[model samples]
Target: MRTLHRREAAAALLALPALALGRPAAAQNSRPVRVVVPAAPGGAIDVIGRIYATRLSEKTGSPWVTENRSGANNTVGAAEVARSAPDGKTLLINADIQLMAKRVMRAVPYDPITDFTPVARLATAPLVLVGNPAGTPNGDLGALVAAMKAAPDKFAFANSALGSMGHLSTESFKRRAGLDTLVVSYRGTAPALTDVLAGQTALMVAPLGSALPHLRADRLRAFAVFSPNRSAQAPEIPTTAEAGMPDLQFTLWYGLWGPKGMPAEVVNALNAAVREVGAEPAIRARLTEQGADPVDEDAAGFARFIGTEAERNGRVAQEAGIEPE
Candidate 1:
């Protein structure tokens, strides 16, 4: 009995170091993590958030749940996360929209660059220019551009919302391509795609993952992708440069963020967890299959990337002629 007691005490002592580090113990004992995704469920951002949440729960042995607080081009949920206690319990999973919100909105409650500490950049998906095949008889980009130039006001373009990446990318395309496509904004990607399918909207620049199904079904036509190279998922679709618009580049990127002042230990632990999970072959393959390239950047690296993105996207917003609303 004495020997058994000693062994038990030793085991508990061994766990003390881990508990102090706050990896498995903190998450397990704390309230369930609330991951806020500033977009509607079923969109690419939401899907990526769910994946990371599930994997994070598995890694830390904690229950992580996602809450959709979509509105104001992703500012609503972002603001919520920003206002949350910086205990690492509440997190935000968002994309480029977070950076562009300030540029296009008259006033955003939270400063995306300073209000949160970046944890990791999960994945990035290139945007694609798609249209209804029936409406766009010429499937190539050049043909589509010529058609739009021929009759500028006759055709309409759709985007998720005014301050969204879709909106920014399309606006940039119009300016760069010199096409006078009218803008049609929707509450979310589903409605925007719905309008496109119904032919109410002629074209849209959206994430390739969301548009892949329709493209496969032949309901929509993919003219060009915005990436520098053709996507493995859809090699048939040429790149924008190949289609004569090399300067047009926009990618839908997803990253994790916590309220400002989260402990460095917690941030480091979460960053390591994301990188470990992202390195798994199965997860990598799955993200790739969905037209996303999983990125393994840490907190500092992601923060720097966000800075660069903000600067570049700011230029995009200005050139798009989209005034703050």
Candidate 2:
């Protein structure tokens, strides 16, 4: 009995150092994090970033600051984040434009996959096809397709920018319908939608959130929405699949990312905080109001999703023969 007791005590003594070492590491807390918004102020990305920053700060007991660094189609801000220290103190909040930028531009400074690590996916907003109510045959998707096909080169589609989500969706629609519509690129969605309203342009593909007011006012007619499922806010509008085009699966999803080499513990901490924020009722409500659906995804899943998006955009750009602006 004496020998057995000694052995047990010896084993307990050997475990003390590990327990002591583990406690300090586990107790370590992160400092305030800075979230970089890769767009101008008053944009959807900025709004989402601010909301996420506020919630993450509250949940982690660490301040989160949103910094807008807009330029170069979000490449300037993304590059800044990629060059920042990988200590979890700096994060990037952006949308699908990042992937399309890489696909269209040949002079990107950093690699999209290698320079940063995905932290989490926050939300997704679907795109909708809208046309001026005062215009030609445009009551439904089939009518619009028929009009575009009949005119071919005369029909024009407006887009937010040269390589934006709106541009890609319009291009995909043209390809799917085997039509030859002229693509008119504007500086932003507001200008493009303005042109469509003023009868300057015939049609456009814009975010459902941005088009909701116009749709409700009857200024624009929504023919189809680009999403895997129908939107709850606008269930009357049919999805692209129901419109007979299942290949048009696209959404403007927002996510968080950090520079490469971020520590595993820090990544885990940020993921937990983001997931909590996404699951909150207030956050979900805000997202719904913005025409965005909250999506809870971890680092690994988001990273994989990014990879797939990059590849898919690349293929689409190639097929469209899109040139950099």
Winning model by TM-score: 1
Regions of candidate 1 where Cα sits further than 4 Å from its true position: 1-27
Q: 88-151 in candidate 2: lDDT tens per residue?
A: 6779998877677666677889887788888888888989998888775756788789887777
Rate residue 160 of model 2 by lDDT. 71
In the predicted model 2, the residue pairs found to clash are: none
TM-score per candidate: 0.90, 0.82
Displacement of residue 293 (Cα, Å) in model 2 is: 1.5
> Cα deviation in Å at residue 82, candidate 2?
1.5
lDDT of 1 by residue, 56-81 (tens): 77666677889998888788899999
Q: Cα RMSD to native, each candidate?
A: 6.9, 9.1
Candidate 1: deviation at residue 267, Å? 0.9
The TM-score obtained by model 2 is 0.82
Task: In candidate 1, list every pair of residues with a backbone clash.
Answer: none
Candidate 1 yields a Cα-based lDDT of: 0.80
